[model samples]
Each structure stands twice: as structure tokens, then as C-alpha cells.
Target: MNQTQLNRMKDGLGFIAALDQSGGSSPKALARYGIKEDSWKDEDEMFDLMHAMRTRMIKSPSFNADRILAAILFEQTMDRTIDGLYTADYLWEKEGIVPILKVDKGLAPLEDGVQLMKPIPDLQKTLDHAKERHIFGTKMRSVIKEANPEGIKKIVDQQFEIGKQIAAAGLVPILEPEVDIRIPDKEKAEELLLKDIEENLKKLPADTKLMFKLSIPTKPGFYSELMKDPHIVRVVALSGGYSREEANQMLSQNSGLIASFSRALSEGLNVAQSEEEFDQTLADSIESIYQASIK
Candidate 1:
């Protein structure tokens, strides 16, 4: 979490394929990609498929980390050994890709239908382990399903609190507070979201190092303040269910918010394609997303 690493985290397109999806999420995501659940009889089968997808992306002949600055990984994937190297180190050594670990234990329902991350099992211990493995950063997620001020504040507060702990351990924290795209009044919600976050941030000591992984703003430039904030190392946008084309369009219009996309990045990749075709599809996706990030 030194300046060099912080600069890299802020520098290029981020791929977030780290999905330790719950039972419900797995099937729905598979279905979205036209994968049939019956093809996988058990959770282990599904996980094998998930791991394959991410590893394919990493090892693809067309894989380029020049624009793919970092990759966030599921904890299980972090431990995976490929070619005698831990996956994190493998990515770093082979592609110059900094690997980040997904540390949250998924979400639990909160009051007013909001959600917060379930308690991470031994969070400090996990951070220590990640640092030892040379993982560059950590990411945790919470949701803002509505525009309620209270809910937004709660998300920001909790993220900053946990983020401080991660930063103290010398790992950068990617604080993701995703605002669900289904809601109307998204522009108003963005304004309130930034306002609340900014107010809370002011109370922290001036040196709190953090980063953001937010939903694409409803309006262009909604996150201008964040981009200008010195305490923030970077501001990245989540695709949040947008199609690849739509996410790229919105991302291009915004200044300073680079993509840390998960589903959108995986949208066109197919396990069934010929190797040449698959590489071309992946190359095209990475180049397009990379272009948007530089803009």
C-alpha cells in the first residue's frame, strides 16, 4: 500500500472476476450466461466452472495486463497454485497484474431491506495472510438498494471503519458500496450518496488511505469530488448489471472513474468457442474496456 502500488491501482482497468457467489446467485449468474444449472449437479461442480472461467481469462494467450492493472480474486482462488506459484503471485510474475483478495463474507439483511456484509471470519488474520501472500489490496462489498439517507450513511460508515483496518495492515481497501441500478431517482441518490460519504470522510484524520468501487454514476461527473479527494487513492466503477456496451458508453462519459467490472468483463467470453475465437473475443473486450479507462 505504498505510493507505487497505490499509483498502479489507480492507473488501469480492473477486472473483478472474484465471485464466491451464494447458492442463489450462482444459478442466476449461470443462467444469465445461458449456462444450465442441471449441467452442474453440485456446488463443487459450479465452483469448478467458476474457477475455470477466471483462470482462462488470466492464462489466455491474449491476456494483457498493461491495461488490466489488478484483478480481485475469491479467497479460494487466491490459494490456488498454478505452475508452482500461488495464483496471486502467478498473476504478478506472468502478467504484471496485481492481485486483490475479496475479503467480505457476503451479505446479510439489515433493517429497511438494506444489506451489510456478514462478519468476516478473523478479518485481521485474513489481512495478515493476504499481505504475506503479496496480494496488493483487499475488496469488500455492501449494498445501497435505496436512496434512504440513513442506509447510505450506514454503508459509508461501515466501509470506512473496515477500510481503516485494512489500510493499517498495509493493504489497500477497495470499498464497494453498490447502488442498485433498478431504483429510480438514481441521480438524486448519487448526490446524497456523495454528500454523506464526503461528510463522514471529513471526520477521519487527513491521512486515511482508501479507494472506491462504486456503481457508474447516474449522471456524468457525479463523482468529481471523489476524484479530487487526496485521501482517495482511486475511484473505480462497477458494471452493476449493465450490458458490456452500455457500461462502456457510460464509463466513457465520466471523467476519472475507471472500470472494475465483473460480469461486463465476462459478458462475451464463451467456453465453447474455438481457442482463436475465444482469444479474439477476450482481446476485443479488454481493449475496449482499456480504452474507456484511459479516457
Candidate 2:
């Protein structure tokens, strides 16, 4: 790999805090902190609450950016200014943390009613916006709840297709096809998922660079082959509803997997806590997740 690519990969180490939860997930999450969506009654009111939450989330990395490589943000949070600095600018210029954008619209039904993220109809427009904001990369998510070969293939192909577009626009794509951990044949599903990824990756240009936001494998070291490919900037594990402790334990056994966790990263963070307490809790979360990531 060239020096630029090497540095990009190295900088991707440690935890990537996922602060991008759209639609139902966003309001539902805020409800946990007593900021109910239904009570807001208007987009502006709801956005006010969300902006408050984003401020706190961004502040978590203020004192120590060592354990956090980047943060993935929702479009709503991306443009907002915090204390006169845009959200992305605040993270990168002030905290030295890379800022990534979540580019996919939420899931829609595919064949057999299988859920997949609808294509970003104006993805290039979004990338153009991201470029103006100085965002570092992009992330999109799809789910594989069953080991259906046809569905898996479609998911992988679509993810790669869009990933290539993202790369062409000069931003790294974190292709996340998350397999539900509740699936019974997790090992089989994982094997097939890797197979699909490998097949698609082989057809891409030799210099294409990307990242993988994967679920914790049923077995440790399941991603060793992926790690050998230099074009893969990082292989970040998603918590998939696991508790922070559970996620950390699973990540600790994996050789080259780090985290890009949303729920798990914010498991203990709440609005009720004092500012000092919140910062401490977030710092502790980063430290624990970081240790496991590099294990």
C-alpha cells in the first residue's frame, strides 16, 4: 500500500462511535432519555432535542480522542453548528476525530419482502455535500437475518455497487451487511457472507479502498483472510444489540476486528448524568472498547 493508504488504514484503528440513527431508531433512542418524539409536535422542536443529544455525543471525545478514530453522523447532525463550529468541523478540527456520514435511507422491502436499504437515488449529490463539509468517509447498512443465498448475494452485490460509487466520489465506504446475531446458523451465515464479500471484492479495481462494518463472528479470527487485503482499510465490528461488556468480550477474541458501535457505545450514556459523569462514562466506554478492538 502507498503511504497515504497505509496512514488511512492505521488511522482507522480503535473505536468508531456511530451516532447516526435514523427514523424510528432516532426518536426511540431519544425517548430513553425522556425526550419523546411524540411530544415534540414539530420537526423543529424534535431537531432541537436531537441537536442537544448530538452535542453531548460530540463532547464525549473532547477530552480524549485517543480511543476514537471517527464518528458516523446522521445528515441532520452533519450541518448543525456547535459553539460556532460545524459538527464535522468540531470533531475533526477540535478533537482530531474523523467524521463519517451515514448515507443510506432506511430499509425497504425487496424480493420475498426481505428488507434492504433503498438505493440512495442521489448518492453523488450526497457525496458532493459531504465533500463540502470535509467529511472523511461514508457508511451504509443492510441486514441479513437468514442464510438465504439469493438474498445474501443481492445484498452483497448492491452494497459493493454503491460502495464503488462512494469510492469513485473519493470517500471510503463502510459496507455493512449485518447478519442478525439471533440467526441459528450463524457460522454458516458468516461463511457465506465472507464468500459473497470476497467474490465481489475480487472484481473491483485493484486500488479500491473500503471498510467493512461487520457483526461479531461466532468464531474468533473469522476475518483473518480479510485482514490480509490491503485495500480493506478496516474491519469494524458492530455490537448488534449486544451489551457493552458482551460486545467488548467478543471483540477481544477477534484478531483484527475493531468496533463501530452505536447502541453498545451509548449503553450507559444518559441525559440525567452530570456533565463530568457523562464525560467519564463515555471515556470509560471508549477505553474498554479500544482495548478490546486492538486485542
Instruction: Give the best candidate by TM-score.
Output: 2
lDDT tens string, model 1, 104-217?
988888655358778887999999889888888899899877778777788888888898889889888889888888888677667777987888678767877778899999
Question: How many Å off is the CA of 176 in candidate 2?
Answer: 0.4
Q: What is the lDDT of residue 269 in candidate 1?
A: 69
Q: What tens digits encode model 2's per-residue C-alpha lDDT throughout 64-171?
A: 367788889988788899889989888878887788899999887756313678868888999999989888789999888788788888889889999999999888
For model 2 the local lDDT of residue 258 reads 89
Q: Give the clashing residue pairs of candidate 1, or none.
A: none
RMSD of 1: 2.1
TM-score: model 1 vs. ground truth: 0.92
Candidate 2 yields a Cα-based lDDT of 0.83
- CA lDDT of 292 in candidate 1? 78
> In order, how many clashes per candidate?
0, 0
